[model samples]
Target: MTVDPELLIHRDADDLAFSVAARMITAITDAQSTGGVAEVVLTGGRVAARIYRAVAESPARVEVDWQRVEFWWGDERFLPPGNPERNETQARDALLAHVDVDPARVHPMPADTGQSAEAAADAYATELAATISALNDEKRRAVPAFDVLMLGVGPDGHVASLFPGYPQLAVTDVSAVAVHDSPKPPPTRVSLTLPALDRSREVWFVVSGDDKADAVATALAEGDVPAARPKGRNRTLWLLDEAAASKLT
Candidate 1:
């Protein structure tokens, strides 16, 4: 069932980040209350970093068991594992390091370790498959029913590394795909395909800033943009600040 997107506008960037941080904590806590590990997909961006920092510093951070939360990335820079530009590196520095998450559940996309982008994507797909397989249950799926899948919308309306009109947008057979000649910097990258992103139970688009207002409006209007594609199984939220939501009708 396709879920309608919900719009949540905040006063400012800080307010947006804090609101998302609180919602994230509550979501994780609710998921864990059912005796299942909470699966969350993280995105990278200035706003996302703020949200992570807020999560790390929140007084209610202890409401959920950090060790029971599984961390995954929506996309990553194809740089070395510890490179400052890598989403994994930023996430660890911002939030993961401060939490008590189990090392075994931290699934970062493959980095540029002398491997081709295609190879890295394949490896990630395999890892996703193996992880899902390990559940060994009747309700088997290609990927986990993520409790929360957070994404950041670029000014160009791209989600993750999926740029508009990119060939990767048509790839539905794979869980992840290699992206080359990206319009943004660090052209070579790997990202979860729309199919994988849509597997989540809840998809949150945490965006801020006036620069993103146009794209956010376009996406909300169901324009021909990649950001308009992925829909959550249970809920889809467009969490934005006043600036980002300004252009919306």
Candidate 2:
């Protein structure tokens, strides 16, 4: 089903990043107050890098207990653990390194070390299941309903690592899957399937740049783009810069 996303446009990338960072802090704080802990799924991109930097510098960073906020990635590049291009490495340098988050709660998808992408994906799924089970005493949750699941909308209208027309997007039972022949460089990745993304209470698509305008517009319109398909259980938000929102009607 195509759920209409709530649109939020900022004047520029800088503005968009800072606003998203602030909103994330607020969401984490709110969740911590009620749930004792909060879970958030992170994404990586140029805009996401900026958002992480903003979060690292924000004054409100101290308002929430970083240790109580669990961090997970939406997708991960199948490369060595320390590879700069890897989302986990970038996220650590951008924000995690600076924050006092619990290392135990920061779950990153397994990186390729000559291991098959499918193996890495299965490992991640098991990790997710274990974490959710440990945290929730009331119910046996295979996938936890994240307080916020942030995604970077690719130029090709992909979310996480699920590209348009990709078979991974059609996967329903699995919470995560392996992308073996992604059109994007690196080709291999482990990503949360649409089923996992939709498990979130809120999903935020943070997109910027004129290059992404068409994808943003197509996602908002009645289309079959993978970016258009995923929706949050409670809220699906599009956080775009003016350039990215230019083509939206």
Candidate 3:
């Protein structure tokens, strides 16, 4: 059952990030209120980093039990663990460091370990499988339908390192993959494939800036782009600011 994407426009980047932080708090508290821990897959970008900071500063953040929430990344730059450019590092610095999240539940994609990218991907795959198994006792699957999966729409219509027209977008067998020679900087990365990313109850694309306007329009249009193909099981959301939504009709 494919659900159409829901477009949400905020005044600007700051407002969009703040709104997303509030929504995230609501989702987490709602799940916790139902006596279940919520799992969220986070993306990286300027807007995402801002969202994290907003979350950390939001007074409503205390409504959710941070320790009960599980954090995962949609993709990560395969750099050293503490590299400032790494998504995990940015996330921690922006929000996680201030939150009381359990260290055990924070699952970051593998970084430099003197192993091949494929080997690192395999290691993360194993870890994800175990996490899903422990989370879903009945299904014991490789992936879990996470409560919320946030993605940052790139200027090139890419999501989770899945570039437009890239062969990695054709992948279906694995939940995660190792990207090499990426068109963007820091060529190597670890990314959750569409299959894994799509395994979410709600998927949110947070985008900002006029530079991403065309890409946002393309994604919202009935297109075959990889960014448009991945949707959530229950809901697909496009959270954009004025600039990013400018090109959308």
Candidate 4:
């Protein structure tokens, strides 16, 4: 385990992405060496977008057996297909679309926005349950263990849909959840619950901005304050650029 959030302070966005790309490459190789296959859960945000693009451009990324990998989303905007705000759409354009991973393995959150968030939540859970059942050796309802999970920390200390002061963050029973009234923009969305997210062997929270500096300090200050500073946890990482790390004390 890392003593701190694996701080990687870079001078600019490009340097940040390169560092993230390298770390991600290491994660992919580690997963492959251990399980012969890798299952990754991806997140969204400005920092993540850069990392996604960098991974796409990385020459070393081709070393992984893309065909043997599966992809999942941590959160998704409840928007129409191809909507600019949708995380899935962004990932498709940024990374997945360029990769050779089988189309069947890319699991985006259910896009039943026309339906109620509750209904969409159930449907998303069902889809993941079916996939997990098929993938697990012990006939589980959830994926045995996600190889890696990448996330973006909202300034409000939200990770995925586990937003601060939100009731859903305390959700202990469900693996996936649907969110309404998001404190951020585009109110309706779906997300993996904290339980679901922590199932991953490795979790990464990448942030890069001056605005996020305070949150970074809180999250790393040593307390189980996911709602206050979602960065607290084990087997997790916070990859930050110099701007985001500036206020850490």
Per-residue accuracy of model 2 over 124-231 as CA lDDT, tens digit each:
989988777787754444556888999998888898999988888889888899998889889989999988888788999999999999999998895778898778
Total backbone clashes of model 3? 0
Top candidate when judged by lDDT against the true structure: 1
Q: Judged by lDDT relative to the true structure, which candidate is superior, 2 or 4? A: 2
Model 3: which ten-residue window has the lowest total lDDT? 136-145
Candidate 2 has what TM-score?
Answer: 0.95
- TM-score to true structure, per model: 0.96, 0.95, 0.96, 0.89
Cα error, candidate 1, residue 141 (Å): 7.0
**Which segments of candidate 2 are over 4 A away from where they belong?**
1-4, 138-143
Candidate 1: deviation at residue 36, Å? 0.8
lDDT of 1 at 97: 94
Candidate 1: residue pairs that collide: none
**Candidate 4, residues 163-209: lDDT per residue as tens digits?**
77778887888777778898778998888887777677667777788
In order of TM-score, best first, we have 1, 3, 2, 4
lDDT of 4 at 101: 84
